[model samples]
Target chain A: MKLISVNDLSLQIEGYFAFKHVAFSLSQNEIIGINGDNGSGKTQLLEAIVSNKTPDSGTIDYTPGVRIGYLPQENPQVIEQSTGKYLEEMRRLSKKLAVRKDQLQAMITYMGLSPYLDTPVNQLSLGLKRQVDFLSAVAGHPNVLVLDEPFAFQSEKTIQRMLDLIIDLKNNNSGIILSATQFDKRIATNFDQLYLLDGDLKNIAAEQKNEPVSLLVFHVSPNSMAITPDVEDFLVSNQDNQIELEVPLKKRQIILNKMVQLNYQFEGMRKIEN
Target chain B: MKIRILLKSYLQLYFQNFLYLTMLFSIIAFELLANHLLEIGNLKKFSLLLIAMFILSLFSTMNLYYNDSRQNKYLKQKINSHWADWSSQLLVAVITNLFSSILIFIFSLLLRDNVLVDFVGILGLFSVGFLGSGIATLFQTQWYDHSTVGQIGVLLFIYLAFSGSVVNILTAVEWLLPPLSKIIMTLQVTSSITKLLPIVGQTLLYAMILFFISGLVYKKNRKNA
Candidate 1:
């Protein structure tokens, strides 16, 4: 079922069209990544979707009862006036918190946000603020999540955790829409549907721009099958006591050395044509 | 639920601009004025002094537009409906002024020397408070941040209202000038209660119309924003 749809929306700003003939739809358990630079109408589109502002000429159609968690583009000063109050207010709005309290607690603990619970949002670093912002949207288990620049200004560890959470939400039948200026290649792999919005919404090719042209297969004895999470991140497939991965040509040597240092007894390393 | 948050925010901002401190000042001024004016032996004098101090305090505080500072656009994201936000903020200020009027009346009950109010006089003041608040709201919405032209005109209007005896000569109708003329005449001549009903009704009518107009203007401004 289509959770939300935007049909031929046009937003004009300062005598120019920020977005023209923009259209897209999001479905359950699917992720649509919007890619755009500054002032490309990404934030306006998200606000229109949430019904915060009316579009110049378009209809953002979504059924009632579909609570959308909108992470706004501008940092609201009200959220910073008091610490932890914003979190509480956000939690109060989420009717699902009564049932998902434990889950939320575990997520907060894992994200290391427990210690800073009382810290003012403005006092926190940009990265921590982003985490707090992300927590506000996810706590409700909202039907649709409209995240604007969710991944910006975050550390690698935090980014990985957010990515994991996004993947988890997708698995739980939640629709996600996000915009970013630049992202790692894994985002392409995680969200297969990507749209490039300059003046209008355009779908980018599904083919990963930096896809590895060569494949490396390593065969290890059944007793020596040991892979750490860091290595598993790049693992494409594993079966029959053999692990296959498409490591970029530039990083293959370092990855091979890291595997050797991990004491994995590999019988052979063969290169396969892409 | 949303109103509670907006009201809390509005009160916090209002106090941040020294509004709470001035409330303390108003109470102290009232006490000193009562003690000093007690010798005059006019009960109405005490009520009028207190009312003047109350108006002074209200006039010192900024008008009740959500834009405390021209740059404070924080409510745009926190609250969704601009009309609700704008109306509720103005209502809080008006209600606070109403409370002030009520408190003054309650204080008047203990006075035996001063005829602080007849039934009609107290009702006149209450109506005046509402009408003043609504006009102030409209004035701030239109010119508070944009320009001071309306505020200068308000000062000129105050001069004219104080000289209502002279101003009423231009009109032949006895009750045409409203609370200003009637209120002045009562202070000068007979303190009759019957002549006050027209002023009360006119003040109320003007207040409602101004409030409705301010709401419409605020809604349009929000849409433009």
Candidate 2:
């Protein structure tokens, strides 16, 4: 079932000519990556999805009871306050889905933030603060997570951990949408689909076998190829003639000797035919 | 369930402000210092200062409430919860009033005179502060953060008109103003009022009325927030 559908949505910032038309459907258990250059309407689109801002003209139909968690680009400050006190009050007021204090604690721990649990949020580094914000948003186990640059300012290890959590949530039937400038290979490999928002919003799907494959031809220098740890595996993978390796631009003799000692084939570089 | 979560979030945000505790301690210290400076025989001056401190406490809480409503994300959610919003406001008012009254009583005790009068004065101060805060919150909910100057003008007008010999005017022209005169009268003659009904009973009645008004305001604001 489609959790959220945005059709012909257009947003215009008042007094400015900036405007964009957006349309998309988010389905259950899907990981959709939104990529775009700076100044594009990526953040605005996310804001519209989160209901933080209403579109100038469009339809955003969200299923009621479909919990939407948004991790904004900027984190708000949570200073030295007793978490239990606030949580207890919320529990008393019955404003939360779950009053299980352990779940909150667990989320804090899962982010590798147990030691700083009692510390003020402002005292934490930018990366750790993002983790806290992410954890807080997902505390109720939201059905759809919208993360804007979730991996920004994060270490590789932390990013991997967050990816694992996202996969876990996806497995549990939660849909994930992320917007970022650069895509990690791990996320690119795991994501179910990709949507690129260029000068104009565009959605790109993975190439299917029956569909015409647009050649994304590029040359790999022999110097770069010589550094390949497993040349045999690289050649075997290139048997489809989709990849072309070029001769090294500089340091060719040294790299050639290394490739020869490793019993690797060093064909003169040529561009791949589409 | 949502109320609990929101309340928890608000409390965290509230405590995080750092200014809250600082203001609380400042009120207590100011009361102590004022008590020390007053002449031992002049209970009226001490009583006036106590009233000022009580007023300060109310204003501080009002400022906090305004800041929270304006800034706290979860408070926006709680504003939608009729029971939680009203109940929390009432609870905060009662606790703040009680704290201010206790501070006044402690200061009076240290001065070592007119204990009964001071106690009665403290009760009156508490009633005024509680009712004033409840009214302010109601007004705030109805009007979006009206100017501080306007609020102060109204409050000063009320004090000038009702706190003195104008009580007779207020009583005679009762229909002109709401039952605010009756509440002011009760506060003005708290000693006799408390004599008629026990202090606890009087406080309970005051609290009940405040809650009732707060409930109406809460419903109105919940629809608006």
Q: RMSD in angstroms, all models?
A: 8.1, 8.0
lDDT of 2 by residue, A1-274 (tens): 7888888888777644233567788888899998777767778788778766667787889988787777887744354444433333433432456325776666556678777756666677788778776666666567888999999988888888788888888887888999987565446667887777764456665432123322122334444433364322222234333343222234335545655564455455432332
Q: Model 2, A40: alpha-carbon shift in Å?
A: 4.5
RMSD of 1: 8.1
Query: Model 1 misses residue A212 by how many Å?
Result: 11
DockQ of each: 0.13, 0.15
- Can you write out model 2's per-residue Cα lDDT over B31-78, one digit (the tens) per residue? 566647755433444445445644554455556565565555433432
lDDT per residue as tens, model 1, A137-159: 77778778888899888778888
Query: How does each model score on TM-score?
Result: 0.65, 0.67
Number of the predicted model whose DockQ against the real structure is largest: 2
lDDT computed for candidate 2? 0.59
Candidate 1 chain B — worst ten consecutive residues by lDDT sum? Answer: B173-182
Where in model 1 is the C-alpha error above 4 Å?
A79-82, A94-104, A120-127, A207-274, B19-64, B68-87, B98-133, B136-225
